[model samples]
Target: MQRNASKPWLGALSALAMLSATAAAAQDKITIGLLEDVSGDIALMGAPKLNGTLLAVEEINNSGGIMGRQIEIKHLDPQMDNARYQEFARRLIKRDKVDVLIGGITSASREAIRPIVNRSDVFYFYTNQYEGGVCDASMVSTGAVPEQQFSTLIPWMVEKFGKKVYIIAADYNFGQLSAVWTRDILGKLGGEVIGEEFIPLGVSQFGQTIQNIQKAKPDWIMTLNVGAAQDSFFEQAAAAKLDIPMGSSIKIMLGFEHKRFAPPALANMHAVANWFEEVDTPAATDFKKRWRAKFPDEKYINDMGYNAYVTVYMYKMLVEAAQSTAKEDLRKVIATGEACIEAPEGRICIDPKSQHTSHHMRLISVDDKHNVSVTKDFGLIEPYWLGEVGCDLTQHDPKEQYDPNNLPKK
Candidate 1:
């Protein structure tokens, strides 16, 4: 009986030792929670974003990792479900305890998980071009906003196309808010939105919408369609021989619609954004070469993917600058406006006041051959709307995204 009791005690000791070792190993890694759509309505764009994130972690780890600790990524596909975003965000913060949370392809998804991150004090990085007006210290937005996108495109559209415009966008916060910005810019430019329609993300058909555009006979159509629902509009427009010029904020760059759809469909499309795959720079070229080397079988990398890639590196830079992974220290470092990185797009820096990034923007026009050309470069445009509307995260973080409708007039 004594011998058997001693054997059980020995087994318990072995189990305790294993548990201790596991805990020690866990301390040797920094984890990032990547919440993206891998297989759903948004996967066409989200997959590239996921690849960018995974690639960054691999590179960081291969180069001896962050602070000599390896990067561990907990990538959960939300399948384009907002509810899943909330659920996974909770899981990441409470259960897995990720060091940082990165990924939210759309403004809807970002807003869905924003509150959860704010409450938990988990550092979040929203790596996609959005409708702007987010003011939060708990998170940093590292993508183009309406100001960066429209400042050049709208003026050029009005100059080349005409003063009359038709608006078509995905029916979400992103689309709705972006439309507001469009009207604001166009109104100032002595242009007008003659007709408009908000299409659901699942609805790819555009027969009636195209007819409305034809009836309106606007100078240009502002096409902000996203995801799988995008291709059909271009195809249907071509079949109808609409032949009108199109001006947009979120067009070919993210979805690569210019590449996906056949010629002339996107020939008249002009997109203004922060990053496009065709953007040529020494930094961008090297980045593409490395991305190709890793993802040889990968399709086109869009703006969202490039933003994710830059943000991951930015996070590493901030963490190292703070010399700690604590959220408090990171916030202090970011508030200094030193949380900047030389990205594929160029030197992108966070505005110490608004917690929004200033982007290197471009106006890219697609040709009949589906080739993209940089028509103009709007170098390092600051996010004007949020700061213009009293968002100063350094002193006071409202921890909320303000609606354009409710904002104070400039």
Candidate 2:
């Protein structure tokens, strides 16, 4: 009887030890939250962004992940609704407790969760080309800023295409700020702005705006619209036969959005972009080869999707460099402006002051074959809005400048 009792005790002890080992192994996994618009207006961009994030995570995990722990991402679709964005952000912070967050294809979605991120003290990496003037200690802007996109593109347009300009943009923070900077820069370059118009978001019919552009007959038309609205505007302009040359801060040719709507009529429209996968560079060629192998059907990867992939790898580098997932330490490392990602556009880095990324911007034009092609390379542009606009970011804390409902009024 004593021998049998002793045997049972030993077996129970061994079971407990095995369970503890399994628990330790599970705890080693690192979690990241990928919040994006996968089901709404910007779904075209969002779907690819999600896929790119997944591809990056897969590559990292396959290589043994960060410090022997696999990286796990929780994908959440906010559906492009502002309220849904806030809710999912709360889930990421409270429920999932993700080590970091990545997403935001649209400026409106990014702005919606900006305050929530600040309040929770989470590191949110936003990947999209947008208007500048955003500096936050907790947030890292990894996309092309106004300096990277507009500053170079606008000046090049003025010189190359003659500078009597007309501006038509979506009526929002991104659009408003883009128009403001365009007007400011054009004036500095001895150019005249003949007309400026703002349209409400999601307004499909652009008949009135097309008429206005035709009547004004500006030397160049600069646009800042996005999503379906941009498609609609271009379609209407083509139908009306308004032939003024158009330039955009957003790269319309980088994705299928323009292909499905604008078609041959969109041929010759110019855009400023950070990267084009087709351009033959060592970095771009390597990326294209790997990407094509992975996705045989996909002909081209859009800029936003490419940025999403880059952001994931950038976060991995930061996590490994810091050797800790503590939000404060990670934030400091990102804000230092020295970190860079191996992107198709070559090495891209963030400017410490503005917290905006600096990368090579390419001027792309739609060709007669209905395919987008790179026309010119502007090379690398540094982030310097304070010098350009005379507004200092160093004087004030980013936290102090952040107001949830009240964005900078134009």
Candidate 3:
């Protein structure tokens, strides 16, 4: 059979039409640049975070999406590398043209990409518990910060555990700064840090560190260990049978270390958290059930995962309230209104002035069988660190993370 030249020309025209249609369809959807560390030292938390974001995006798309526009997420794994975070942030902004940005497990990673988003005028959501005091018009931190966690945790530890404690934190901006907050809060609570240690990520063995803690023999241990390798500290402590009561700001909540490690590993482990899989609220139970139905293999829904899930819905609320996804409009809604959401963990409200979420915190512990239960409830703590220190995003966009070292004195 002989093909006609006219037919060949018709096929080329059809292909061109299809390309144009695809581009138009993409333009109709709102884009989200999702950066997560699905691999490397922080994968334990990052992989779960990506899963939660995907789940929320799917639900949002199914429910008519944000402002009638479907969400199209452009995901990139930074692998816990700061350089990769910067490169990926730039690519997502310049190439993908995403309407919003979300991710960053560590404070270092947040600082790495925050400037890029600020310069590009992109809205950003950081959904992990961190050292507080980030003030920026282009961002909202929905995670529990030191003000929410340490304020309640330190006092509880001092009241129950003892007045003397040992702190083992990771050697990074988050861990180091969290350590500082712990010291400050504990000191205020009339407690003292008898021994302090900072461990680098990917250090599994804790022989020397365990010896140090044993020698110090404080009332209890405050474990700020982060990442997968550092999780081994729980196992080592168990093996050595360091039966001393321990408290933390992260231990069981962010990493779900109790569920991952063997029984008795986290026997005496206690931590302050905004939410956990076992929170038992009707919303929390439904969320856990649905997540398990979708991801049958997932072990536990940690705090980071819940934060990612809630932050996505928070973005939806902001878009619908503002009637637009433009950065300026969203900023206006956040700046003008006390934005609140009924998440799995009760009510979470945005502190408009500080650009952080007020969290419902609790002190929880795990038994030898790895069962977690709330020991005490500290209801709805507003993120007060930035506001108390004079960093108000509504008044000015400083574009800086205020820590103990660089805080402005009122």
Candidate 4:
């Protein structure tokens, strides 16, 4: 009896050793960190974006993952707070030591966390349709930039409608830089900027702004506004019976304001984006199907979601080509890698110099019943504005984001 009992103990010890070894191997798995806003003013955009990232990650993991090892994600909501963004970013870089970091809804939030990730030499992806001009080796932007958006949008709007453009934008880095770009583009179209107003982030009442627009009587309105508070602008514009045609570079698709607010409020509104929920393509159809399967209750998937999805796949491709998760190794692949990734919108190639993707943008209009229709498609446009001002990541390890000031005025 004693001999048999000792034999059982010996077998137990052997099994314990194997379990420990397996756990150690699992610890070496790649970890990706996501800092997003799920319950704040920007949550309208952030929640869908996070859902999109999760969907792509699940797809990649189900497809044998990277190097036969599983990929894990650590997600945290920053509530659209700048301080929380910095704090959470530090924890992800220093404590979690995540291989890649993704998410940043606003330009201010992005700027807050960018330095921390850059210092730690971790790969960071910011997928918001921002005010362009970011150049960093450790950073890759898959979002539509101002030049990419306005170049196609402004000319079309100017041709369809008269040239006096009224502008209303949120007051931040994105809004400020976008205002400059708007001025430049309008000037090129030989149009006049009749009036421009910058509203604070959470200012819901746009009574004064609406009154100003009425006074100015511009031919069309171009809005760079953001957040739920800014969404009220559409309702107010309708109540005031402001019949001016509208064009937007960022708001309509990212915020899904058309879905949130009813028709007539957003009727006859035109916006340009790389992707929309209604894009008729096999890839897009499949993406929507998968998204519905995972989140049956979710209503819409906008460009914000599309950006998140594309960025993750792009990172995966770069990692596979590099065959390593080390920042330096991945940077080399991204800085010089030439590969096309099929996104829901279309095939996109990352510019080795600027780290921005070339996108096929579509001009869309919202009807009185809140239906979106694609009017025109601008296929596969490069970030020529950034390229023109000497954006090159391989030349040196410069970590500064360029301003749109250097871009050509005319």
Candidate 5:
């Protein structure tokens, strides 16, 4: 084919258009402040989350940028320290003046930074699943709530195992609230909780706790532990040979505990989660493949990472639709919205009332080979806890977090 002289002129015009767009993007960029731990305590979970967040940012920028403005991300590692989290949050808000903020693997870290971000009127997103029932106008949670998780999990566990149960959790807001949810759900379901314990954060020795569990001898055990140190519970429980059917709503498959621990530790353990790498779906499988391709050294992409990825995309949609990063404007857009994004788990919807993502929770069983199997699929469940508690951000901003005890009984 012979090229015409006019074709050269057309190419020059296209290059000029590209240059002009680049110059425009350079002049106007959206800043996103990221707070996550790359070392210490929650690093195992935080590192993966950071990776997922960066991946989503990369995808967004590549796909014509966010509203024609390139996204600028300032990632800070708090090293799993609450004081550091507060400091970094202040820096991001006061110094960087980021338009949007996303981070905090632990509920403690989130609470530490939440007030600062909310007071500063910054759009904040927390991607990790926790105890639930956080009513705040300045935040959007992309993780599954207690109602979505335990509503399916408790019933299944009770039916599979017996009614009697033992509960163990980390001593913090997330664990405390989760314990309450467990007791409340069991009561409503006509089941009994035989025992319960709260282990301090980073407490490894579960000798007394194990003895208590064995003595109580409930039908099963449910854990809400957090951090790498808490992983010892699995090994210790297995060592004690207290092999009753065990389950966890908060952190079983998170951080790939099944893979990290030996077969005996997690084998035959049951869990209910928002997302699992073993999910057999086109979207999930493709996400795993892409994750592997990007981070060849990493072996697992758990719910935390998956949720972080979804949160970023969720923010992108809200920001583009709102066409502004101002916190109030973003909240206003979310108030009248039902945003949906096809996540690795499935399609998650952001509820207008709750400002939390509705997820498709799965009943997962781990085998001796560290393989995960989906026992039951609880199709897309909403964060009804907030709505039940009469949390309406549109009408008025409560500027507070709600717990189950404060709300009506289920």
Candidate 6:
């Protein structure tokens, strides 16, 4: 009886050891949570972002995944609501137990989840061009900041258009910071900001703003409206016959939604972007072909989508480099700035201090076909353009450093 009991105990121990080894070997299957907007005003940006992220994951998995285990993505829709975003963040961290988190189409949404992310202990990657000056330890902002978006565009517009400018933006953080940056950069470039107006987000009527624009008669109309507000503003601008050469920051001609909603008068409008499908770059072409083949019905592909897709691949690269799903280890690897994505533009690298990715920003125009085409490519812009100006514009305190509301006034 004693000999039989000893054999059974040894067998149980052997089984447990095998299980432990399997678990150790399977550490490459890094789980990520995608908190994005699929159904809301910003769905145009969010839905495609999710699709892009999935495509990246699919490609990575097909290419043998990370360290032999498949990468898994758990997606959640926040519906563009702050409260919902907070809840989703909690679910992603607590229930889903994701190793990393990515997705935020708007600055408001990013702001909403910032605190939750800081407390969650999971690495968060924000992949949208936004208002600048965010330095957070827990978050990596891979999107173009104010310096990346406004710094180049402002000077370019001043040189191409005229010195006098009118600024119109949604009354939010993004809008405010964009307006401030426009004022500052244009002023430095010898341009004058003649008029600046802030409209509430989703406001349908722009007749009054147009009237103000006409009265000011600035040489160029600089805009920062997005989502429903952009639709309303452009529609009303066309209806009101406000025909000034307009240059905008966010959602000027982002995707099919903007192309469909914006009137013909808004054609040839210029905006700075990280990527456009028409650029004909090797990376862009390959991504477009694969994406089109995969989702034949999909009409438009924008930077928002491309960024999300790249994030997944970036996650894969970091995971593979670390060879484990340990969140802290992956975070350190990504934060090192050594990891890069072969994006459409070229080699995209993260700014080690700010944890923001650097990529090419193009000065693109919407043609008569409602298709966006690039006119001039501003080579890669780093994360902190204002770093020289005494601003610790790194990724240490993203929330404290970036406040769209407290933007500079003309």
Q: Which prediction has the highest lDDT against the true structure?
A: 3
RMSD of each: 2.2, 5.0, 3.3, 4.6, 8.5, 4.9
Q: Which stretches of candidate 5 lie over 4 Å from their true place?
A: 1-27, 408-410
> What TM-score, over all chains together, does every model reach?
0.95, 0.87, 0.93, 0.92, 0.91, 0.87
What lDDT tens digits, residue by residue, belong to model 3 across residues 7-71? 88877888999989988987689898999998987787887899999999999899899878899
Give RMSD (Å) of candidate 6 vs. truth: 4.9
Candidate 6 lDDT over 1-410, as tens digits, reads 78768699787888999989977654646778888888988786677788898888898889887777787888988888888888988998887778888987778888888889888778888988788776666777777777777877778878888899998888888788788888778878888899998877777777788899999998888878777655677767777777777787665435544456644756657888887566687767887999998877665787788788887777777777877666577766765668787776788887666667887888887764567677788888887653443334233343455433342222
Q: Which tens-of-lDDT digit does each residue in 130-203 have in candidate 1?
A: 88888888888888888888867899999998999999998899889889888988999889999989988889
lDDT of 5 at 200: 89
Compared with the true structure, all predictions reach lDDT values of 0.86, 0.76, 0.87, 0.85, 0.83, 0.76
lDDT of 3: 0.87
Clashes of each: 0, 0, 0, 0, 0, 10
User: Which candidate's TM-score is highest?
Assistant: 1
**Candidate 1 or 6, higher TM-score?**
1
The residue ranges of model 2 lying beyond 4 angstroms of the native Cα positions read: 1-26, 253-258, 335-337, 386-396, 400-410
Residue 54 error, candidate 6, Å: 1.0
lDDT of 5 by residue, 1-410 (tens): 24746488877888999989976664598888999888997778778888888888888889877888778889999998899999999999998778889988888888898889777878899998888877787889988788888888888999999899999988988888888989999999899989988888989889999999989989988878877898798899888887888778765557788878887788767888888778878888888888888888776787888888888888888878788777777776777765777777777778878788888888898877777898888888888878877887676567677775776333
**Per-residue lDDT of 59-89 in model 2, one digit per residue for the tens?**
8999999877899889899988888888999
Candidate 3 lDDT at 152 equals: 83
How close to the true structure is residue 319 of candidate 6, measured as C-alpha lDDT? Answer: 74
What local lDDT does model 5 show for residue 296? Answer: 81
User: Candidate 1: global Cα-lDDT?
Assistant: 0.86
